[model samples]
Target: MFDLVYNTIFFASYSNFYGLGNITLGLFDVILAYIVTIIVSILVALVLKVPLLPSKPYRYSFDVSAIYPTPIIAIGILSIFLVLNYTFMYNGIVLAVVIGILSALFVKYLFDFVFPKPLDADEGEDM
Candidate 1:
């Protein structure tokens, strides 16, 4: 029934990476890794005194905040590691946390140098 079809299609595709008897982490491990990433990101941002939200209006703000870039960057990096089959073992969780903290630091410090704002075209103009 459904198991037969699923095994045929899903395993066929998955076998390329996982192989016939490869050990893999469960869903809980994946979820826990993501949770670690998120929590570490926010905590690091708060410790560094990143604000709770963007300073300028949401539409035109590049500021990093406790609730914004921290979690987003953490999740993004975690997703990449997950796709590469890395999980929450052998200090993988610590690595994710470090990455999350580093990303927040980069956003706070080096982002402007890496992605500077464009000059205003109407500067020094009269109304």
Candidate 2:
């Protein structure tokens, strides 16, 4: 049941974009698409006014911000498509861009809700 729904969505998405699978695409192109997704996601996040880095004491901060989480999300999603052999139009260029944009927006708006900040910070509880 799970595989049926998974294949239906992933394969249907690729077929709609006329994806011919990785046969027509080289490893380099696939790699480039992942890189593009990362770059575009970061760029969009920056444009959305996300800080380039976390706040002071960055090492311990639990904050989720653009430069870090945005690209991470984009590449992760792109990897899913790659692993599923579901490259979309333009050798995944279009898919990468879409992923990048959506990831940035998600990080900017929805990440906090998904991963709420630690509320006991002032209590100095070791994490």
Candidate 3:
């Protein structure tokens, strides 16, 4: 009984079975890609001097920073690539690093231009 349960659960957990061709990625590899992308993005953002956190009391602030958008951008882009089956290297470590670097740069330089903040005067009117 225990063996039956274990084998059933293991069926869908691997990229391929003993005699079948590989299709989906192993769970560990996809998770590793996400983790690496997030770490690299945060590190690059810190090195670039993007603020580590949002503005003070920023429950509603529009400010983009290292912790807020850097990882998010990196993970989001990585997801798109993964969905398209475009991991540039086996296990996707290289793709993760490249996405992380580009995301940090985009947040540091192009973010404000692409997503301009509203006028400060009325920013907190609702509060």
Q: Best-fitting candidate, measured by lDDT? A: 3
Q: After best superposition, candidate 2 residue 79: deviation in angstroms?
A: 0.6
What TM-score, to 2 decimals, does candidate 3 have? 0.76
Question: Can you write out model 1's per-residue Cα lDDT over 10-124, one digit (the tens) per residue?
Answer: 4333544645345554555556666877888888888888898888778887766889877887777766665555544542577677778887787678767987766666785
lDDT of each: 0.67, 0.77, 0.79
Clashing pairs in 3: none
Native-referenced Cα lDDT, model 2 = 0.77
Residues 21-82, candidate 2, lDDT per residue (tens digit)? Answer: 44455555766787889889988998988888988799988776777888988877887776
**Model 1 steric clash pairs:** none
What is the Cα-based TM-score of model 2?
0.76
lDDT value for model 3: 0.79
Report the poorest 10 consecutive residues by lDDT, candidate 2.
Answer: 1-10
Stronger candidate by TM-score (1 vs 3): 3
Q: Estimate each model's TM-score.
A: 0.68, 0.76, 0.76
Query: What count of clashes does model 1 give?
Result: 0
In order, how many clashes per candidate?
A: 0, 0, 0
